[model samples]
Target: MTERPEPTFDPRALVRSLPQSPGVYRMIDASGTVIYVGKARNLRRRVGSYFTRQAHNAKTQAMLAQVADVQVALTHTEAEALILENNLIKELRPRFNVLLRDDKSYPYIYLSSHQRFPRLAFHRGSRKGPGRYFGPFPSASAVRETLNHLQKVFPVRQCRDSFFENRSRPCLQYQIERCTAPCVGYISEADYARDVRHVEMFLDGDSNRVIDELVERMEAAAAALKFEEAAGLRDRIAALRRIQERQYVAGARGDVDVIACVVRESMACVQVFVIRNGTNLGNRTYFPKAPPETNSDEILYAFIAGHYLGGNAPPELIVSDDMTDREVLEEALGGDAGHRVRIRSRVRGERRRWLELAMSNAEHALSARMSTQASMDRRFEDLQERLELEAMPERMECFDISHTQGEATVASCVVFNREGPLKSDYRRFNIEGIEAGDDYAAMRQALERRYLRVKKGEAPVPDLLLIDGGRGQLAQAEAVLGELQLTDELTIAAISKGPRRRPGEEVLHIAGREDEYRLPPDAPGLHLLQQIRDEAHRFAITGHRGRRGRRRQRSSLEEIPGLGPKRRQALLKQFGGLQGVQRAGVEDLARVHGINRALAERIYETLNG
Candidate 1:
C-alpha cells in the first residue's frame, strides 16, 4: 500500500474525497494546524454536515471561517474511529474540541511482585509492571493514608532500591515496626514474602479475606505459645478493620464510577464518585471546555469520550442524564473494558441513592462555580461601563514587559474572559533582535508575533488588547495591529502608573480618544484593570527572572577550559538535577556517553567545589 497524500487547501475538495467508511477527521486552519477533531461512522456525511450546519453558533462560525483543509484517517469500525478520535484529541488538543482540562493520571497503591523482597510503593501513570495496583485513587493524600496504614499492617519495605541495598543496619522504619528490615537481613525472605502476599491481598479489595487470614495466623501463633507475634497479628487485623469501616459507603453495590453533571447558564460541572468493591474511595470534579450554546448531552458525551474511552473504564458508569449517543458510548466503553460496561441514567435501590448523592454534589459544585463566575461577569460589566465599550468585551488580553538593568528581557500576555483567567492561552515571549533596554522594540516584537497569527486566522482576536505602559507602549502595539490590518473592531488601551506610582492613581489611555480616564480609589472597574495589569507584570517578571537565573546559575562546567555548551548540556541531562551533578563521583561522571576520565575528573572537581 502507498502512503496517502496531504489534503489540498480547499475545504470542499478535501470533503469530496472522504470515504463513506467510519473514521476520524481533523479540521486544519490556514496555518496548517488542527483546529478541531471528530469521529463519524460515515466520513463523507459527517464532514459534509459541518458545511450544511444551519444556525451555527458563534464558535462554530469562527472555526469554519478559518478552515483551510481537512484530513481523514479511516478505521474499520465506528468504535475504532471513536478510539482514534480520542487519541488525536489528546495528542493534538484542537481548539474547537471539548478539552479535558485536568488530564493528570490518578495515583495508585502499587506492589512490586517481581522483587525478592518486594516493596509497597505509591505510583501513578501506566500500570504495566509485574505487580498489583490497588487504585485510581482520588488524591495523593488518600494514597498516602492507605500506604501508611498498610505499612503498619503488613510491614513491607518502602525505601528506594538504592537506599535498601546500601543499608548497614535496620533503619527507623524497622525500629518503629513499620518495616520487615529485609534490607539488613533482619527478616527471612520466606517470612517477608508472606507479609508481601498479605499486603497484596489487602490492596486487591479483599480486606475481609486478609482479616480472616490474619485471624487464622493470630490463633496459630497463640497456639504455638508465641504471645508477642499473636498480639502483632491482632493489631494488624484491627487496623484493617478500622480502615475498612472508615471507607465503607453502603449505597454503591459494586466497582463503578458515578458521573453526574449540573449545567447552569451554559456552564457545566461534572462530579465523579469513584466506587470500588462497594466502597466509595472518593470523588473529583471537572469543568470541560466547550462552546456556550453547546447542549449538556454533547458536553457529557464529549467528556465521556475524552475521559474514559481508552483509559480507565469502570465496570459500570452511573451517569446523571441520558445522552443522544448513549449506545455508541456504551459500546466503546464496553470494548475498552473487555466487558459489558453499563451506562445508566436511571437507577433503583442502593444505586439510586448513590446517584442521588452524586447529583446533589454536582448541583452544589455547579452553584459554587457559577457564583465565582458571576462575580467575574460583574467585573466585565463594570469594565464595559468604565471604558464606554460598544459591547461587553468577552475576551481581554493584557501585555507587560519585564527586565532588570535591561538584561534577560521578557514580555507576557495574559488572557481573561467572563469565566475569569484563561491560563491556557497565556504566553511569554523572549525579547530578541533589539537593544536590551528598548521597551518599544520589545513590545513591538511581542505584538507582531502574537497578532500576526490572529491576522492569518491562526488565533482568535481578543475584544480588547491592553498595554501595561504609557502612550509609547500603546503606540508600538497599535502600529503592529494596524500593520496586520485587524479590521475586527478591537479596542486598544494603555495603562500608565500615576505620577507618584500609586495603584489606584493610574491613568488609562484609550486609542483614538484624546483624554485620559481614571476612577475613584474604590471603583470595582479600576480594581479589575489593576488586577489584570498586575497579573501581566507578575507573569513577565517570572519569565524574565527565570531566564536571568539560568544564566546566573550556570555551573563551573562553563568555567572549565575544554567543556563546551554541548558537553555541559550532556552532563546536566545525564545527572538530571543540580544536586545529582554535585554528588556524582568521578566514576559516575566518566560513565556518561561523552566524557573521558580527564574531563570527568575536571567536572567532578568543578561541581564539588
Candidate 2:
C-alpha cells in the first residue's frame, strides 16, 4: 500500500469549520508537535479569536506563530472540556501549556478497624476503598515522623496484616512497647478499640480532648495501683502534649489550602500550606513550568486544575491569587472532590497570615531558583570557553561504566544543560554478550546503542559528550561515534581518575590533544565536568545495585503458588527477610496473611527443597 502525503494544517480553515461547543483544541506546529493545548466553551469562537484583532500577549503570539494546524475534540460539557484539557496538557506536555509536574503522591496515614486490630500505616497512592485516610501530608518524612509518635502514644499494631497474622511471638515493635502485642493476643479487642479511638481523635485534630482523656485514664490506673499502666499513660500524655506544643498555632477552624505563586522573570514557584481542622499540617512548594511573563492567575489556575483534578482531594477553601476564572476551576474541581469549592485571594486576619506565609515560601523558592540558574549559567559559560567548541553545548551527556569486579556490568549516560541535570533523559544500558571486566567492550556497546538512535534521527544529538575514562575509553568512544558518522561534528572529551583515585587532580583527554591537561581544582569548567561525570557514575552504580538487588530478591519465593508481590512483601515483613521465610516452620508460614495451610506447606517445601 502506498503511503498518502501528510495533510497540511490550515489553522484559519480549521477554525472556520470548528463546531461552537465545549471542546479541547490542540495546536500543532509545522513539525507536527503539539505546541499548545487549551479548552473552550465554544470551539469555533475560541479558535477564531486567536486570528481575530485581539491583543494576544507575547507568549500567545509566539505560540500562534508556529501553529500550522488546529485539531478539536468536542466534549459534552464545559467540565468535560476542562477534564480533557488537563489530560491532554499532562499527556502531551505541550510547549505552551502550564504543566503540573508533581511526581509524588501526597502521603496519608491510613487506618482501618475491620482488620481486627487496626494497623496505622503511612500510605500514598490510591485509597484502600474502606479505610479512613488521615492526611495529605506534605512529605513522606513528615508522615513517618508522625507515625513514630503515634506508635509510641497509641501502641496500636503498626505491622502489615500478614505480618500480624503470622506472629507467634511479639516483634521488636512490641519489645520496645511501641505496639500492644495484639498480634499475640496480649491486648483485647475492646482495649485496642479504645486506643484506636484515641488515634482517631488526635488525627481529627482534637489533641486537647485526647490528652484530657489520657490524663483521666492515667489517674484511674494510678488509683488502681497499676503504676506500670499509669506510667505508660503518662508517657502517652507527654507525647500528646509535645505534639500539641508543636502545633500550637491555630487559625482557620476548617479545611483550607493556602496557595500562593511567585513569578520571577521566567520561573514561578507555587507554595501550598494545608490547614486542616484549625491545625497547620505542613507546606509544599511546586514549581510549575510556564512562560516567565505568564499571568499569575493563569499559572495558578493551571496549577490548581492540574493538582486538584489530578487526584488531590480538594478542601473547602482554596486561597490563591485572585483567579478571574475561579468558577470554571471550582466547578471542574468540585465535580471530582464532590463538594462545593470556594476560591479566595483576599482574606482577613489569620487566613491572610497563612496566605502571606505561602507567598513568602513561594518567593524564597523562586529566589533560590534564580540564584542557582545564574550560577549554572556562569559555569556553562566557563565550560564553553575551556572546551573551545564551535558553540556552547545546549545539552551535554556524560557516560560512565560501573560494576563490581565485572559482575553486573552496566553503563550509564546522564544529560545536563544550563538548567542542570536533565534526569528524565538519563539512560542506563545493561552490558550484554561481552566478556566481564572488559571496560572497553562495555563502553563500546553503550555508545553504539545510544548513538545508533541518534544516527537514525530517533534521538537528539548532544553537542558535547564526555566519557569517564582516560585515552583508551576516549578512543573507543570516538570509534563508536566515527562508525555512526557523528565524530566529525560532535565534540567528545574524556576524564580519567587521578593517580591514587584523587578527584581534583583528574586528567582531561581530547581527540586531537596529545598531552592530557588538568584544570585547576576550583575552576568552574572543571566543576561542571566533575558534576556531570559524578552524576553518570552515580547513575550507573545505582542502576547496577538495583539490578543486583532485584536479581537477589527474585528467589525461591517466585516458584511458590499464589505468592505475588503483596504476599511476598507480607512474608518478608513478617519473617524479616527471604532467609527468615526459608527458616520459618510451615505453621508459622501458614499464619502469614493470605497464606493458608496448604499454600504455607507448599512454600516451606519449595524453599526447603
Candidate 3:
C-alpha cells in the first residue's frame, strides 16, 4: 500500500478562491484541531484581511502562524451566519473563542393546567409538559421566592399531585392560611377557580386588575353579612397591595433584561437582572471563559448570542456596553423569539439606573472572585510549606462522621483543590452493620467504600486525607489505606480539638510523626484546615439529620398497634405532621375519625416514650 502525500496550506490561495458571501469560518491548525471560529458578512474580504493586514495583536499573530487550513460554511444572511457561528462555537469549543460556560437551564414558575385545582411549582428543565411557565428566572431560589409570596397572597395550592390526591383533611398549609385546602373541599370549586385566576393575573403583571377584583369581592362579602369572609378578603387584598408596591419598578412595564459586563486584568463578570411584568425576579452572575485581552463589548456580544438564542429572550435588552453587532444580534434574537427585540445601550431614567446597578454588581463580583483566587493561592502555599510536602497538594479529602445516639449515622467526605472546595466530588455514605456509637467502625466502612472505587480508577486519588478525630479515627483510616495498598500514595493526618475544645486550639497528628503539630492561632495553613474540617462536619450533620427525620416520620407511627396506614395518615392530616402528633394529648388524638380512646392512649405512650 502507498501512503498519501502530506497536505499543504497556503492562506493567499485559499482567500483567492473564497466567495464574498455571509458565512461562518473555522481556522484549523496542522494537527487538525479548530483553533478559532468566526463569522463574516463578506467571506472573501474578511479571510483575505488576515493575510493582508499588517498590524495584528500578539494572539492573532500566533494564531495566524499555526493556521494550516481554513473552512467556511455559507449562509443566506448575516443573522443566519451569526446563529451558525454560535452553534459551532458551543459544539466545538475552539481554544480561541469566547466560550460561555453556562450549562444549567434557567428556572421558571410552572402552573399546572390540567388539574381541577392547579398547582404552582418551581421548574428548571424542558417545557414540553402541559403547564404555563411564568419565567426563565435567573435562579431556582428566585422562582421559589416568587412562588412563596404568591401562595401567601393568593391562597393557591402548591402541593404535589400525589400529596393532593391522597389528602383526607387539611394540611399545615391550610392551617397557616397559605392554602385553601382544595384537596379536602374546604373551599368551593368556584371560589378556588377565582383565586387561581387572580394568581394568573398577578403573575402576568396585571396586579392592578387582581386587586380591583379582590376589592369587589370584599365589598360583596360585607354586603352579604359575612364578616369573617370579608375580613379574610380584606387581608388578602392588603398583602397583594404590599407585594405590588415592593416588586413593581417605578417606570417599567412588560418584560426586559438588564445585562452588564465588566472586564479587568483578563477576567470578566456578567450580571443579568430579569424583569417580568415590571417585577424584579432577581439577578445572577456569570463568569464566562474567554481568551486573554477580550473586551467587555466582545464578551457581552458573545453572551447575548449564546444565551438568548436558546429561546427566552425578552422583548427589550438594556446593556451596559455598546457593541458593533447590536443590530445583527437583535435581528437574530427577534427571529428566535418570534417577536421584535431591541438592544439599548444609551438610556435615561429608570432603565439607566438599572444598568448602573448591574454594572456595579458586576464590578463587585469580579473583585470578590479575584480576591478569593488570590487567597486560595496563598493558603495552598502555606499548607505545602507547613506539611513539608514534596510539592503543593493538588487535591485533599476530609472525612467526618455524624450521628445522634448512634442512630442514622452518616459519614461525609468533602474534597478541596487549589481553586477552592470541589463540591462536585463531595460524597456521603450511610454506614451499616456496625456497632452503635463506633466512630472507628464508621470511619473504616466509609474509607473502604470510597477507596475501593479509587482503586478501580473510578475517582481521582487525593494527595492528602484528613480525618476529623484523634488517634483512633486516624488508625481506622491508616488501616483501610494499608489494606488497599495505597498507603504510599497519599499523606494522612487527623485534627482533634485541644484540651479546652476551642477553634484556634486544635492539634494535628500526622501518621508518621510521633509528636502532634500545632500552628499559631493566625496561621493560614491552620485556617485552611479548619475550613475543610468544618465543611465536612456540616455536610455530615446535614445528611444525618435528613436520614433521621425521614426514618422517624415513617417508623414512629407504624410501630403502634392497631395503627394502620389509614389511621396513621388520618392522625397526620388532622394534626398536620409528626411533631403535631407528638404534641397532642390522648383526648386530642381520639378526636380524629379513626383513632379510639384506647388506640390514642397507646399512640401517645409510644410517641412520648
Candidate 4:
C-alpha cells in the first residue's frame, strides 16, 4: 500500500481564502501536533491578526514560532465556535491551552428508586443507574455530611444491597434508629415509602414543605394519644428546620455558582462555591495548568468552558473577573443546561459577599501554593550546590525497603519535583523470589523493574536516585543501573542514619566518591533528602502492612479440599470471624450453606491444624 502524502499548508494562501465567519482555529507544528486552539467571531480577521500583529505576548510569540500550519473549522455562530473550541481543547489538550487538571466527576447523593425500599447513599460517576440523583456536590465530604444529616432525620437504609439482602436481623443502623430495618420487616413497605418521600423532598430543597407535613402528622398523632409517634415527628421537623437555617444563604435563592480566579507567579487557582435552591452546598478549589502570560480573565474563560460544559452548570455564575467571551460562554452553557445561564461579574447583596469570599479564598490558596513552591525551589538549589552538579535536578526518586522479620517484603519508590512530592509518579513493588529480609536483593529487584521501563523510554529517568541504606543498597542500585546502561544518565546516592536513626543526623554516600559527606543539621538540602526518604519509608511500610494483613486475613479454610469461596464467605459471616470459625465444631460448620458434611470436616481439620 502507498503511504499518504503530507498536506501542503501555506499560511498566507490559507489566510487569503478563509471565509469571514465564526470558527475555531488550530495551530500545527512541523511534527503535525496541534500546539494551540482558539475561537473567534470573524475567522479572516482572527487568522490574519496572528501574522499581521507586531505586539504579541511572549506565550503567543512562542506558540507562533512553532506553527507550521493553520487549520480552521467554520461555524454558524460564535457560540457554536466556542463549544467546538472547548471540545477540541479537551480532546487534544494542546500545549498552550489553559487546561483544567481535575476533571473527575463531582459527587452526588443518590436515592435508589428501583428497589422496594429505596436506599440513600453517596454516589459518583455515571448517572445511568435508575435513581434520583440530588447533587453535583463540591466534594465527597459534602455529600457524606449531607447523607449523615439525612440519616439522623430519616429512617432510610444506606447499606449496600447485598448486605441489606443478607440480613437476618437488625444491624447497628437499625439499633441506632438510623434505619427502619426494612430487611427484617420491622416497618411496612407503605411506611418506608413515606419516609423515602420525605427524604426526597428535603434533598429537593423543599424543607419547609416537609416540615409542614410533619407538623400536621405530629398534631394528628398527639390528638390520637400516640405520644411516642408524635414526639418523633416533632423531632424530625425541628431537625429539618435547623438544617434549613444553617444551609440557607441570607438573601440568596435559586441555583448559582460563585467562581473566583487568581493568577500569581505563573500559577492560577480557581475557587468555586456551589449554591442550589438557596442552600450553600460547599466550595471546591482548582489549580488549572496554564502559562505565565495567561491572565485571570483568560483562565476564568477557559475554566468556565471546560467545567460547566459537562452539563452540570448552575443557572447563574458569579465570577470575580470579567471575561471577554462571557456572552459566548453563557450561550454554550445555557444550551447544555437547557436553561438561560448567566455569567455575571458585577453583582450586589449576598452574591457580592459570596464572590468576595471566593476571591479571598482563591488568593489565600494561591499564596500558600506559591510559598511551598518557593521553599521547594530553594531546597533544590541548595541540593544542587551540595552535590556539585552542573544544574539543578528537575526530578528525584528515592527507594526504601520495608518488612517485618522475613514476611511480606515491599519496596517503595517516591518521586519529587520542584513543586514538592509528585504523588502520581510514586510506585510500590512487592519484592518476590528473594530472601524475605534481604534489603540488597529487594533494592536490586525494585531498581531493575523501575529502570528497565526508563531504559525502554516508557518512564522518565530521574536526574538523581537515592537509596535509604548505606553502601550495600547503593551498590545494588549502581549495579542495576550499570546493567541497564543508565549509569551515566543519572546520579546515585545513599543516606544512612548517623546514630539511633534520628532525623537531622544522617550521612550521605555518593556513588563514585571516596569520602562520605554529612550536611549541617539545619541544611535545606539535607532536609529535602530527609523529606523524600521519609516519604519512601512511609509508603513502603504502608504497603508491607497491607500485604501482611491481607495474607493473614486469608483463612486456612481456603486450602481445604472442596471448600469454595461461597462456603468460606458463609462460614465467616455466620461465625463472625476466623477465630470464631476455628472454634466451631465440625457439626456446627456443616450447617452453613453450600457446605456438606465432608467439606465441613475437611475445613475443621485444616483450620484446627
Best by lDDT: 3
Scored by CA lDDT, what does every candidate get?
0.81, 0.82, 0.87, 0.87
Which of the two candidates, 3 or 4, achieves a greater lDDT against the reference? 3
Task: State the lDDT at 521 in candidate 3.
Answer: 80
RMSD, one per candidate, in order: 23.0, 21.8, 16.9, 19.1
Model 2, residue 81: what's the lDDT?
89
lDDT of candidate 4 over 486-573, digit per residue (tens): 5655789999999787888899999999788899888899999999999999999999999888677674667777878887788889
Deviation of model 1 at 249, angstroms: 3.3
State TM-scores per candidate. 0.57, 0.61, 0.65, 0.62
Candidate 3 per-residue lDDT, tens place, 1-609, comes to: 999988689788999999999999999998999999999999999989999999987768888898999999999999999999999999999988899864557777889967788988767679999979888888655665677678778888776777789889886567667788899899899988888888888888888989889889899999999999899889988988888777878888889999999999988899999998899888988888788888899999999999999788999999998999789899999999999999999999999999999999999989987887668757876887887765467689999999999999999999998778999999999999999999999999999999877754457778789999999999999988865545655789999999999999999998888988888888888899999999999999999999999887779789888999999889889989888999999999999998899999999999898
For model 2, the superposed segments whose C-alpha errors exceed 4 Å read 1-10, 102-104, 373-609
Q: List clash counts for every candidate, in order.
A: 0, 1, 0, 0
User: What lDDT tens digits, residue by residue, belong to model 1 across residues 1-609?
Assistant: 999997556656766888899999899987899999999999999998888668778878888888888889999988888888888988898988887754457778878888898887768678887977888886554666677677767888877777688889886567667777898898899999888888777766778888898899999999999999999889888888888898887765668988888777878778888888877788877777776667767777888888887557888888888887677788898898787877888888888888888889988878876778656756776888888876567688999999998888999999987677889999999988889799999999999889865543346678789999999998897778764444224789999989999879999999888999987778777878888999999999999999898766674567987888888888889889656777899999888887899988888787777
In order of TM-score, best first, we have 3, 4, 2, 1
Q: List the residue pairs that clash in candidate 3.
A: none
lDDT-wise, the better of 1 and 3 is 3
